[model samples]
Target: MQAEGRAPGVREVAAAAGVSRQTVSRVLNDHASIRPETRARVLAAMEELDFRPNRAARMLTTARSRTIGVLASSASSLFGPASSIDAVEDAAREVGYAVTVAHAASLEPFDLGAALDHLRAQAVEGVVVIAPQQRVQDAMAHLALTVPSVTLHGAGDAADEGVFVDQLRGARLATRHLLERGHRRIAHLAGPGDWSEARARREGFLAEMEAAGADAVVSREGDWTAASGAEIGAELVADASITAVFASNDQLALGVLHAARLAGRDVPGDLAVVGFDDIPEAAFFAPPLTTVRQEFAELGRRCVARLVALIEGGDLAFEEPVAPVLVVRESS
Candidate 1:
């Protein structure tokens, strides 16, 4: 047979490499049963000929597009969904899968259903929803998709396969750290009530304060923004009795830091401040804020792994609550 100056076909490559066409197929498909040496040989031959596998043909044969869908909230949020997206993409690529991202920013009840339906129509093998807000969780609670689905930051009843960091534990750590620093009157600058993270942190702070036999000052709700943090921080400063404050997130904590400077209160000298999320800026805050570090990337990777297992009909167990670490810095 006369071979043209084109990339070799699988059969030609297999013949050249002294392997069966089926062996080449298995190697290209990344089947684990093939011997490593055999796979190396097939891969070398294909490389020598610059042969590229036809993705369309492969998808048709396998009935899989080799893609997973990630449904998350606003992509603009650096701390949560955005971090998760990066982690999922990195982990999926490591396992030979591609990721498609869908943002459910509004997460309206109807919109949540529509988003899931849309991802399903795209032929995704599985879907992951990163729902931190209670409304988003409620929206997902009514979904009955047979396609394997997992939720991140979901409440107790959204999905059986859910992943969440221990926000309560994080709060306790932040509050306890301040208490150890000799701050008796501690207040909370909480995130919006709609968010599960914020609520969990509030509960954790309350629990730790009651356990320490210290007075629990009323919490001021912030919208997880620097402006809200500044506003609430000023209020706490005006009260004259609050000596320590725990902000739900780093952004808000930055605002609190600013408010403290404006009020001429020396951090850890006149007042102590702690925050959560331990964002990159947290380490560079004026006094290098003490905070809790939530492993956003790890959470994302685990969520995808569990969803993929469910999609593949594999028996997998849900992971227990992930722990958050307290990062000690100059702020406290």
Candidate 2:
């Protein structure tokens, strides 16, 4: 066994296991031809000597950096994308890969092109695109990237291998929750039309309303911001018949909640409110918000896992959209 203080080399491990350094290297690299007994002996020797293969050296020799590129939205600091980034990093580390992030604040064609070029230059094995804007999807469609890539919150055309939370289902859940509470004249505060997630949510809400045979569906557009929610919420509150409102996301929901307070409407007793994305602050809202929760982290991990598998020439499967869960609380 090699001394504890001394870092063991390939040669030392090879000698201890009665195998050539080349054979040990091949085994460590997951080469299929090595005998089972030989591989086991080499692994045992490595354990005894506390030998750690130098990743940098191995990467240099194999021309495989074992690094993945993440093209996250510039607005990633916000709720959805930020949580996704964290999940991607966690999954990558668990699988023995490192992640490099690029913030493409704008989804313009030129910006996405430049971002892809930058990731290619970094020798990334795969890429996970985290932007879902129409412009971003258009930019991604134009890029001629040969590297394996997947997009989060993307439409079917974005990538054959990608993952997205079921925004439409979440919207339906929120609307259904409100309806079950006996709110007939419910309103929806939708996010911008350019975002795929927003569109999906809108579709879900409309579908649910149509199915329920509701008399009318009132809607207002928001920019997925607290201020937008507040502004639109005020309009919804102006109508005495509007007894419930569903905001597209938590920030906007918070704004709606504020607007409700400003309008002096008692929640649940006089009005019910539901939001999507169940962000951390949703629970702490003035009356504790009832919202739909999308597992942003799970979405990120799936994106990275699928892209990495594709990069490694492994099987890739398109999974159904992950379902959203409704968190019941005081607000609704």
Candidate 3:
């Protein structure tokens, strides 16, 4: 797929489809009078030339772009962000809206601001933010926002805005599962401090630990990577008092499992391990894994529905809360 030259415009699309410019325009705008055969021809031409209709140009007359822009902190390979993004796209398409994603080059404020500006330049009617960092949320509050927007997160709180997946409840569930198994001195392998999800999860863990009157073994700061977890776990092994672990994510739990093995500790015997975010491969991990599962698809759909409602001037307080489930497995 190499570029021939400048992108094909409406004229080129019309010529390729062997239709009049008016016919091509009608097809692009989804006019009620356009014939199905002609519309198919135009769509085929668009596919062949990789042509995309310019929403900004069309908005000149209708003042409606029928598009939503997404501002993500970064396009990380993490499953939670990736899955939620996919769900948002699917849900937006179902409601006849196109999605435009602008991912920050980094998690820095400068990159986030640049990504927001780029999305704004596209003239999107509304925007959805998928960045869950506290700093990003702070940045959003200061901006004199001119567009209706929604943000999806895992903070586990009912707010005046945003859709959350109840990270606190999930963390408590994970911690309780360990406690029920008669394990004491439970350890918490937390994620990055700046992330709202990480903070919420740690809060839940600490609360549960204190509630149970158990000594808390909080690990060092983690970056939500297996390598970081392994590094932290290596240190955690030296603590003979710690008997259970709840990692903020599955990857970290996997590292803890490895660390336990190296130290000749048996899972569910010497140490019970649990994780959050029941990723697909969790079931197949060496001894399986106990995890907390958030409804990412429902979270995504609700986010789009909320943002669209905001754009359409309908009910902005629908308040569809997404709950998390605890999946019990062998490791715990």
Q: Estimate each model's TM-score.
A: 0.89, 0.86, 0.82
Model 2 spans > 4 angstroms off: 1-24, 32-54, 155-162, 216-218
Q: Pick the candidate with the highest lDDT.
A: 3
| lDDT for each residue of candidate 2 in 32-95, tens digit (9 for 90 to 100) | 9999999999999999988888877888878898888988766778788888888899989888
Which residue pairs show backbone clashes in model 1? none
Q: Per-model C-alpha lDDT, please?
A: 0.80, 0.83, 0.85
Clashes in each model (backbone N, CA, C under 3 Å)? 0, 0, 0
lDDT of 3 by residue, 7-120 (tens): 888888888899998888888788999989989999999999888777778787578989898888774458788888888999999998989999988877778788889888
What are the per-model C-alpha RMSD values against the true structure?
A: 3.1, 3.2, 4.4
Off by over 4 Å in 3: 1-61, 157-162, 318-320
Off by over 4 Å in 1: 1-22, 45-55, 155-162
lDDT of 1 at 122: 71
User: How close to the true structure is residue 281 of candidate 2, measured as C-alpha lDDT?
Assistant: 84
Query: Which of 1 and 2 is ahead in TM-score?
Result: 1
What is the Cα-based lDDT of residue 193 in candidate 2?
Answer: 89
Candidate 1, residues 246-282: lDDT per residue as tens digits? 8888998898899999999988788888989888888
Clashes of 1: 0
